[model samples]
Target: MAVQEHLIESQDRAAMIDPFVQLAFLNDAIDDLTAANLDLLDAEWFARYARSVDELTARLDAISIEARHRGHDRHCGFFSTKAWIKHHVQLTGSDAHGRIQTMRMFDLLPTWAAAARSGEVGVAQTRLMARVAANPRVHVGLLKCVESLLVDAIVLPYDEFERRIRDFQRSADQTGAETQARLNHAARDAMMRQKADGSWILWATFGSLQGAQVNEVLAHFIQAEWETDWAEARNRCGDDATLSDLQRSEPQRRADAAAAVFLAAASAPGDRRAPLPTLNIVIDDTTAEVIVSGGRLDAARYNKMICHTQNGDPIDCSEAAAIALWGHIRRVVRDASGVVIDMGRRSRLFTGAARQAVLLLSDRCLWPGCDRPNRNCEADHSLGWKAHGNTVPWNGGTMCRAHNRLKETGNFSARRQANGSWTIHDNDGEPIG
Candidate 1:
């Protein structure tokens, strides 16, 4: 380890340009492809080159692993082994960790690895294939068959490949995993798809549903709300203060929480909806009207854009901005596009730089015991956001929904001191600094 570290330090000390540029160049070189030639090419060529690299790299990795496992001792057998790679490359703790993991996936599954290397499959399709097929050999077969149809499979985006892989798995018809290999390998796309605006058409469900099954249900729920008059839903709430108030107040305050995720198998447009995850911030129909008319309460100003004039007008602001300023919740937000690149914090006094730093510090969520990725992770103010807890990165940490809820519901408390490191406490009062 020490020798490897020294070798990396010497390499870093040597003059070099940008890491990003270097990575891009190296990625191009591996495929026997060059950017110089790409200047005159079409999109298809890019796909082909990517496919080539995927195939070449996968083959190299498999060979490298076979060599190492055959050559090395019991511990640290593969070059792509994350800890080994990170130690050898001297990567930042996070980049080193992530690359190591991704590479290991290629190493662990030979068939998918070969398919990836052959540029015969898209990453998303490959990932789904890996999950559904579950065996190295099967994945390899999938790659061979799937790649045969496309000019450059590597260039194909993940989303585009999802349905195709499913079709192949089902033999182009609706069926369960065709074989044990398919069952062992297939993984559902866990991410909810997004549009340029924060509003997502997500597939929502609870209780172990997968793919379009959940989304079809959500399409029904959203349709139900949009199609029916609000009178029934609201009246039910009004008749009982608790239930009525619950729907009106909580739902209004918590519209972002209500923004359901779509995980449907069929990407084709459909009509269905799912019951919303409730936050219990009920608003009376009159209150909804008042808030939309510019009631100065934080919820009014915040969700005015999320909520409406009781007449269902679109609240012209980004749902993120509306939720951030008024909802008293720090939302995990995607740029007007639907991926959570940054916590929607520009309006809350935190800059993008700070958000980046927090993400880096935590890598994912910092709930101590959780491993949610950055997309589900939020930038949490060590102190409460409204309690004059500055939105500066120094006062924040990347935390996922579960822990963020911990902070919000007061199950945990965070203290940021003069030096800016945070100390968090649990229900039993043990402190984690």
Candidate 2:
């Protein structure tokens, strides 16, 4: 029966062979095939080998330094360090580094390393074993136990492999959340690869909230000017109060108040864009404050705040006149019609010279973990716009289109309080509360 089994597994003599692959496998398997015994290399003996390896590595490094002594001119680019190793060392990039690290790991752990080296399993599996064996800190910390539990992972059935990993993590007190976070951080890669050619469009689905947060932060940093995006706003809020601090500084604080009054005076809450009007508010040395109502205010309830001018004098008026004036202020408060607004279109509009006011209200993106500019985001109705959301920037916010979709579709939601701030939530109908 044994003879029959051997004959059944024997290769066909007529089959073609690749000398390169055969040599590669032999070389790859040698370390694993070697047993760990004092006779082979005790501490003293291995010390000599270590010295030799170090000297050889130093010589190789010197060669690299000499080659780059001068600024690179591409004259000998093909003869660079990698090319030299591939040609003379006869090793691929992946193989070379892996071999070096694996050998180091093996030498550092004799018994466990030798078992892995001696074909207890294949290269990938053995490599994992070597990793667990060599790291004393991790070994002591229980991560090493994963190796014994997941031995021969390369050959293990998928179900078995999964079971072992879970078993190992659970028994070892390792949490999936922690493992996933590490993987994401280590492997995270994002780039606007084609944007170097100058195109203003990008599209990709974010697989996690972490990814979306990263994108938000990056968007603000990439802009040519300080954009009122959620990311920038968050950055501003940290350690420094950002725009709030800047606008409220001793030199600029009064203007902040004036801007608020101007915003409040100009905001027409109901039928938002009733009539577009421009008014500049100024109060020198005295404290000034304004509030721009983004949505329709129940005027009968909150009429006292807006009807007052910069001097704090109330404008006594007919309900009809107040209603008309309210609409005009709304349009002028946010000139963009809640669409494409280039504050740069009239630099003065954003500049202190024009002394124009932005809708001074909630300042940041409502998205959790998102500190972005309100300006860059879409003016989304916390409630659906079609469902009675007025087209006023006061009722609006600057949110990226991405968050806008999430808000609109109920994947995310926000509710602005009567006090003009907001609370946000994620897709599961769970408030980020």
What are the Cα lDDT values of the candidates? 0.45, 0.41
Could you give candidate 2's per-residue lDDT for residues 103-176 as a string of tens digits? 55555545434444343434444445444444343344333343444343544543334433333332232233
Report the lDDT tens digits of candidate 1 across residue range 100-184: 4444555555555666555455544544544545434344344446434233235433432443343343332212222322443
Error of 2 at 210 (Å): 4.6
State candidate 2's TM-score.
0.23
Q: Which candidate has the top score in TM-score?
A: 1
What is the number of residue pairs that collide in model 1?
Answer: 47
Q: Each prediction's TM-score against the native?
A: 0.27, 0.23
Residue 417 alpha-carbon offset, candidate 2, angstroms: 56
Worst 10 residues of 1 by lDDT: 303-312
